[model samples]
Target: MYRSNVLVCGGTGCTSSNSELIIQRLKEEIAAKGLEQEVNVIRTGCFGLCALGPIMIVYPEGAFYSMVKPDDVPEIVEEHLLKGRIVKRLLYQETVVENSNSVKSLNHTPFYEKQHRVALRNCGVINPEDIDEYIAVDGYQALGKVLTEMTPQDVIDVITKSGLRGRGGAGFPTGRKWLFAAQNQADQKYVCCNADEGDPGAFMDRSILEGDPHAVLEAMAIAGYAIGASQGYIYVRAEYPIAVKRLQIAIDQAREYGLLGKHIFDTDFNFDIELRLGAGAFVCGEETALMTSIEGKRGEPRPRPPFPALKGLFGKPTILNNVETYANVAQIILKGADWFASMGTEKSKGTKVFALGGKIKHTGLVEVPMGTTLREIVEEIGGGVPDGHTFKAAQTGGPSGGCIPASQMDVPIDYDNLIAIGSMMGSGGLIVMDDTTCMVDIAKFFLEFTVDESCGKCTPCRVGTRRLLEILNKITSGNGTLEDIDRLEELCNYLKENSLCALGQTAPNPVLSTLHYFRDEYIAHVTEKRCPAGACKALTNYYILEDKCKGCTLCARNCPVGAISGTVKKPHVIDTSKCIKCGACMEKCKFNAIVKR
Candidate 1:
């Protein structure tokens, strides 16, 4: 056995940060010290704490190293691996207790202590590219049990009893969806996994596919058995290159191991899975649009009553679930419904994984029980908003969801609770905002994303969202009237009512929620022609505070538009007419003299 094992994060976040260089340096160092036989380096997926990556964890000691660089590898190998001395400086601060030489367990850290890892069980634990590592973690055992022991009805019944709702926005009952497809009399039903996570800050789906591709594969095969499906398709976005590459690897491995293709577990049930790469269309996240895209057409939503379960994917009965949803399926089947049902709230069973981003301190991925409060996630788990900035609002569910204001910070995060507060649990993306954020600008930002991503297939999403974007632009640019606010509300409701798909129906959520909670900011923009948060450039004017200015010409020198004029030892003055509101003068002022309002 190897005396020491070194695990390096190979996820997209760490890879972008040159974690690959760290890995290469580690191998070279280990070999140079002639400890290659005693040491092993393994590349794994994300560790959830994206802020501190590229991360390295030395096993046996479990020394969690953050921001590991290529230069640090020699010292780590020579001292830690060769001499067996811990590099206290490079260790994550949370792992080191106050005045204690010994390290704390990585799990006991605040970021991870409150989290419950179900879907992400194998992530950051096993090598995703290796089939043996996944199998050793009991990966395909769920499919084996289902294929050998349980009937199709038995599989469906267990899932139904588990009270597990879909994690992909709508919170529909997964078992009920499966049952509908199972009940339909079709010779060739289909199972699909939606890995097209288009939310701005969401990476939950991509992480799962990259770290635990075999888990999704196993769940898909189980879904096939339960729904009488002979084939399955995973609709993933092309932008997720790591996830796609790893998923394809897992598929090849599963087929080679007889876990996927042609009579899995040596049974008569014949099933297989294929991949369909999408061109990163946000509308394809909706079921009908995803299915249509898989059928070699433009990724656009079709009118419903004929949901994917009844009529989908080439007009046949099909069941589709997203990556996070599928990641939970095998666990629910293996551990029993009661085990899965015991953790969460009454209606929402099982844990939910969220990609926490924006102004939060510890921005990364997190999974908490369904009823966990936003306070716990944002403050305790997320390390709260950074730099003493007060929390303003959190945007959940991307453009398809709404913002949760500070007043609702204590609210429990679940499908029903989120919907009650003018937001939906849209694929578990939670972006925290600071007090500096402009609510009106936030609304406009999401509206712009929706306007760009709308497939133009339906009139409500195509034409209506564009009109809403125009009004928001007019308001931010200091050209809007009070009547424009009323017009926005009216159009929002109209689109919600008349939209053909969920994308259009929920596109106005950000605008509606901001208006409901932060109406003062909007009113200020319209009446005073001033942005309350000073985020809208047209409504903002930057000025130098005479008292705070140190008579330094730094602001004047750095001003790109030559808007600032001052002597070397005197206070600076800004020419507001010439100022582009670019804040270059403010950024150069060391005395904190420049201010915008």
Candidate 2:
């Protein structure tokens, strides 16, 4: 009934930027003017275009405001909410027009011009805290339909035809997993949802659970019904307070509405859900590890003979899926088989949600078709590399993934395509890198993460990954030899061949991928005794270019160690021993004097 609704982002990104204060200010201003009845302020989940947060969208006109601060709220309420005028200065540049109409809305923004939000359909569009809003969007209708009409075989048939795969790193067939649990003859069965997203660059699952929580709830319920289970557990990390809060709210709301618990929709289907908090171990991402964690035991992976669906979660037949995988369940059942299958590529069907981060123009959640090329995603949609640097590599997955070079820029982004080119789809985190990125350092960075995060349950992951880290540390510190490559290759293969779980199995990916794509850089580190990208501090030497130097003395002033010896209007000499390779000299030199060689 309100004439205008000021929607402020309640997602973690904007909330950190003081978006909640903006909402409070707007409410106070509207109430002070006695316009509270006509104007209302609401806090919602992430709007996907995260760079513009703390984002505020004015309704009726759909005027998009990006990066509005706490102080800016009063002006917005007074000028736009009260007087019915638009904030010209605050409007996003891409959507702005001269006059008459408001900016073309978030849909017309350059960053979202090419994004397709299938997996993220109801994410930014609905209030995740409110169960009614999710229901209004046909949220539990799929569960209702599945329970009342469809049989277990029918549910399996629909999902199988849809070609939906697990969105949790390993791309196993979702229907097949359910069928395995359904076929089992255990006295009791259970379903579990993996919400412990541990990848550094990944937030796709977190966003879905935060934005459209009911979708996961409904999907889990349907999964429970489909697999002949009466109980479920969501293994989520306690670190994600926002996501945890929304999920708890959704569960309570579902129970209140009879969407969960005994006799769901009066169909003799008695089911309920519980939550188990993860201590935030990366190894718990593995199926056996996750089930073990759910049982309050030490989280680690075990060899797979009888997978989770056959015998899991306290020795009960259990089917496990990650947040993103479960998020697609209701849609696949409601929209039919071919509808979901029609999207993505042959091997990988249905769109995948990617957490686009690291050096890209747009760093947020994106869901694109499977066959979408890496070039189109980075250049056309990601706005290419920020600051006009040439694209070097993109690291997909997380510490477990690999760095992709520019040579495979046109490779179709799918499961097989990525694995074939020494990379994997992982759980959909695409981190863009530019020429300034050092491949050796990047590989070392990921390997270091793998080494620290390894559960030590297996010798391959615990011992081999640690040894790989030592070699990477040696190479970066300028102590490597040409024979190190052969040695590193030997270790990587040994780890791969003798790994216990997927964590140990893919631990050597980053090292192998970088070595395959940027071998010249590795050779330079050994033969030329230099870091090609000037990233490894020990192998790099910084010097101010005398010809390019205008003798501004900015480098000398900015250098923390006073490495540059220079006087005004005279060329400078860098004391190499005193230089720290922090790039302060390069940042201060306006004339491009500070050079890395």
Candidate 3:
């Protein structure tokens, strides 16, 4: 056995930052130094503290290395691997706590301190491709327990007591959804996992599948046994190639171990799973549309009253939950219900994972308790807004959710609290914004995404969202009138009232929320024909600050249009008539002289 193992992050975030090359170089360096027998190299999934990647942790000492580069390999090898000395320089800044001698492990970091990872339990801890490693963690033990010790009704009771709900936008009770399928007297029953994570900056579900594929399989089998279904399907987008490949490997591994297929765990529980690839339609995130596509039909949403729990997947009794939701199942069964319920807020009992993104300093995956204040997430954990900019507002739940303005920063975040303020806990996409962000433009961007993603199932969503986009575009372009703003508001309500599905109905949220929170910016856009943030090109003009202008010809030379005129060592005047407001002068100016107003 090797004396020491160097584990490098293999998640997409760290991989992009050159963690793969570090692994290769570490192996080479160790081999070159003849320490292969003494030193081991490994590549693992995200360690949660994603900003510190490319991360390398040396075992035995558990020396946590942050921002490691390829060139730093030899020193690490010679010093740490060869001489058994800890490389202090490569260690994370937060390695030591403020008032403690114990080095802060990834678990103790403030970024992970509040997070109780039930669903994400195995992620970053184990290599997903290794089946033996999964087994070591009692991977299929939950499935075995369910099949051998529990009845169909018992499975439902455990889950119901666990207080688990769908993590895929709609927070329907998971146990209740499964019960509907079990109670329906049908010759054929089905189970589906909605792996079609279509939210624009959301990757929580994908990361779980990529890091812990076995968890989902175990949970699905448990679901199958509960619902009396022999056949199960995982409807995942084709975009997630890595997750897909690992899932396929996991399925093969499960079958080989008799955890799936006929008489699972040697009980008369027969169940199997199939993978259905989607052609990348955002609207297919809806359960009905996903099931329809699974049946080799056109992908579009169908109206629900007979929700997927009762009538889904070819009019059979079906149960559907997203990847993250299923990821929580086996753990809940294994850990007990009160253990799961004890973590989160009163209304929302369980930890929530967020794809922490946008203007924040720490951009990565963060799972926190339900009632954690936005201030704690943005300020302390997120390292505050980058460059000391003041926080403005945050957009949660992707295009279907609304913006939470600065005034509401102290509100405890949970499903009900967010929705109370006109936002919903949609698959957990939290995008932080700062002073520079234009709420009008931000809303317009989400509206634009919804317009393209609408399934055209109904006129209100298809035509109505497009019209809303047009009004937002007109306002940003300095062409919208007061009447246009009124018309936009009317359409937002109409779409909310008449759309056939959630995707269509909530499409106008960004438009409505931005108008509510940042009406001053909207009025500036419409009344004065000016974009306060200078994000709207038509409403902005670029000016060269006379005091700071170096007049190096950088600005004038880089101007796409020859609108900037000046000589060396002199301030330039922008010919507004010829200016396209492209901000080329601002970008090329080294002296910080360009200003937009």
Highest lDDT scorer: 1
> lDDT for model 3, on a 0 to 1 scale?
0.86
lDDT-sorted candidate list, best first: 1, 2, 3
Task: Provide the global lDDT of candidate 2 against the true structure.
Answer: 0.87
| Residue lDDT tens for model 1, 438-509 | 999999999999999988878888999999999999999999999999999999999999988888999999
Cα-based lDDT for every prediction: 0.92, 0.87, 0.86
Collision count of model 2: 0
Off by over 4 Å in 1: 98-101
Clashing residue pairs in candidate 3 (N, C-alpha, C atoms within 3 angstroms): none
What is the per-residue lDDT of model 3 for residues 44-141, given as tens digits with 9 covering 90 to 100? Answer: 67776777788888887777888999999999999888987767777887675445323567667667676777777787778888888899998988
Off by over 4 Å in 2: none
- State the lDDT at 312 in candidate 3: 90
Candidate that would win on TM-score: 1
TM-score of each: 0.99, 0.98, 0.96
- Show model 3 residue runs off by greater than 4 Å: 96-103
Model 1 local distance difference test score: 0.92
